[model samples]
Target chain A: MSTAVAHRPGLHSWLTLIRCEAKMVVRDTAGLVVPIGLPLLILVMNASAAGDEEITAGRTALDLYILPLVFTIVTATIGIINMPSFLAYYRRSGILRRLAVTPASPAMVLIAQVVVSLIQAILGIALAFAVAVLAFGAHLPVDLGPAVGIVALSIAAMYALGMVVAALAPTPNSAVAIGLVGFFGLGALGGLFGGRDSLPGPLATLGEWLPFGASVEALSNAWAGQPVEAVHLLSLAVSAVLGAGIAAMFFRWD
Target chain B: MSEPAILAEGLHKQYGDTVAVDDISLRVERGETLGILGMNGAGKTTTVELIAGLRAPDRGSVRVLGLDPRRDRGAVRQVLGVQLQHAYLHGALTVVELLELYRSFYPDPRSTEELLELVELTGQRKTRFEKLSGGQQQRLSIALALAGRPQAVILDELTTGLDPRARRRMWAAVESLREETVILVSHAMEEVERLCDRVALIDAGRILASGTPAELVAQSGAPNLDEAFVALTGKELEIEEESA
Candidate 1:
């Protein structure tokens, strides 16, 4: 309560900004629940339903497919829905504009959001894996390297698209609206609900080139102990580059 | 003599075809509170932004603490604290938490407790920003602007929505910082008279008059600053109808 001022060592503004943003993310129930809850829910529900179904010659539904689709849902839910909503809220509330006048640039806030969302996505993936192993006795991926690579690449691609939504949406509600559309539309076309083959001729061809569909295919292959497809990996990389580039070019502070 | 804490010369800004601030020159000496009095859309906020380096002027130059505000923005931010009219903090952060976070941006900052006490927000330390009353929020915003222990501060529309009691408390808090240079943008004549060492009356993106409260009163041949403001601005009939 004393009016005397004190001098303290200066901390890097970006670190302080990231820590504050992380605290806000933890307090945000809706932001946390969607990325964490929805993926776990899908994992348990799908596991229970696929009790004894064999999708192929020797592979059960849980063994080679459900986990990858669950991973897709995790990445898409965070990158396409949660990230855009949080960023748009910051923009609309003038928090970003306020930071512009401080020593910290608004880009630090964007980086912090991506970092926190990635951490949440990883936690979601780990929880899904635990449930898959214990409740369903699903086999682990033969090689962890390729599986991890596909997951990381997919997340990068999805989050890049999320940045596009955050940059373009004029308001928080519009960002959420655009995010949800991207989530569901990509989920359907990317074979998160089912196999890509089930889609019609033109749709299946188009979905094959999309980052979501490419990621699902690459993840499924890696999980099944097959080498990752070059085209799918390329598509995902291209999507990440293009999406991030566009978002960076068009982002507005106010 | 030390240079003025803030200096702007022939500053002009426009949005599309409409001029916001036109050919305005201002100087605020150290340890002085210069009140910028203007009606709504009088370019008071725009002038503040230009001095704070938040907006680049279409023409003219601005220097803050002897450094070009636009080119030395990073250095200027180190000593220039600004509380913008529409700026907002995160709603979920507690008062103390927000203060501490802002404190980290400066090498020398006032303690959280002191800032809260100065603004009479010590009792609301644990309250979330969204939970605070409008007056409390305004107080917190001011506290944030002062957190860096800045040499100069700009407060735009600082007491616009405050109740009379809250406005008095704000004035007292601002009064406590009399040793630091301050540029206050306000529409309240009484606030300018009580707190400002010198006042500038701006209208339609131009400064109409600049002097102490008494000088302005005498120049306008009015008994008080309120009537003097009206007389000088030629808005006497409008003021009478509004007050009536």
Candidate 2:
């Protein structure tokens, strides 16, 4: 009998897994387009109107309000909606269970998926920025460092919530349904439909504390050359931690 | 004596009020093919799942290649390839792509072309998993199990839904793996009789008998292993018609 133990999967294996994941994400037409297309549509529709309304020295309402909202939409849609559905499908279809038996652990799938989703998110963000600047003449954020930092935090925060949705959802359809509820629930309160000013006082306050509201507010502050509030940052950090904790506790591979 | 490839001692598992596995013990020597014969819901799949470390036994131990499956899962996974009853794979991946991905997971994996030829899937190399026929999908699953060049392999219901032609082809694939330790879980007596060196009859989460096919027939005073199975387990073997 051969007594040789198998070698651990190397970088080549991970790259192949990630490539497969990327292919799946690309092939799913609706999933591929919606996260990028919907946000771009919203950005274009709002950019022309917001472009003429200058908020500070040179930056318009486009930079402070519309750009952040558009970027937030990109991250939230992909992180909260697309990523979880893929995870739910993998679990439902037993793909994760199948990988568990191989030298390639199932955790590798999750990591590969996250990597692909991050790449998709980056593409969406870059596309939105390109259109905003080239097409609508939008300017960069006054505080570029913080704006970039906030967007990264928002991505992490949204992905954490996506993990929770993937954990609780029994099927892909359920994942989409729950993700939509989450995206809109947070969006509506976070000033997606309109600014939080129009919401009920309590809801507006609640929205300010949620990832969507917190991200938009922080990004808006950074764009407007103002200091981001500690409260907004705290909201995003807490959501990320809590969402990860819940997912780790309840997630099932199959 | 050389250590056995697989050993299970008094394995017991339960789900809620249902006892899925109960006090089952087995030992499979290196390079030996052991057939586990049982009807549906006779804990066949559950038994293999325990050996593969997919589920932790409630009250026993399992070791593969002298390593505890649960404790040494990383090492065991390197040597133990499992083909479950379900064809659980990414639906959109083509046969070759899936084979390539699984191949990359092992340091010494069989080439995609080699696996495709082994399962007679060369013609369907570019075909998507969901697009393959049920038999073809089962064959692909078997190929994936063999991709890692595992020393110990477990195939659960390998040909359950296959047509006779496909079943014969699958048997040929198994025959080529005679050098590896194999635990074949199936309801098909013909498959066991042809491929396995020894057979164990199980019923209601317990082993009814264990011996070579001839020995099983002699012990039960039956005409063949099929009749021996019925006499030992007190259950009629129900062979489903070929559907794919």
DockQ top scorer: 2
**CA shift at B42, candidate 1, in angstroms?**
0.7
Model 1 residue A142 distance off true place after TM-score fit, in angstroms = 1.5
Candidate 2 docking category? medium
DockQ of each: 0.44, 0.61
Instruction: Give the 10-residue window scoring lowest on summed lDDT in candidate 1 chain B.
Output: B235-244
lDDT of 2 by residue, A15-77 (tens): 999999888877777788878899999998888999888878688989989989999998899
Q: Model 1: residues >4 Å from true position, as ranges?
A: A1-15, A51-59, B236-244
Error of 1 at B178 (Å): 2.3
Per-residue lDDT tens digits for candidate 2, residues B33-122, read 999998888899899999999999999999898888878777888898999877479888889989999999888898888899999999
Per-residue lDDT for A1-254 in model 1, tens only?
A: 11223333244665776777878888887777877788778778888777467665345677677788888889988998988888888877889877777666677678877877887888899888888888887777766799898899999999999989988887789999999999888888888677888999899867878888888788878766778889999998998999999999988877
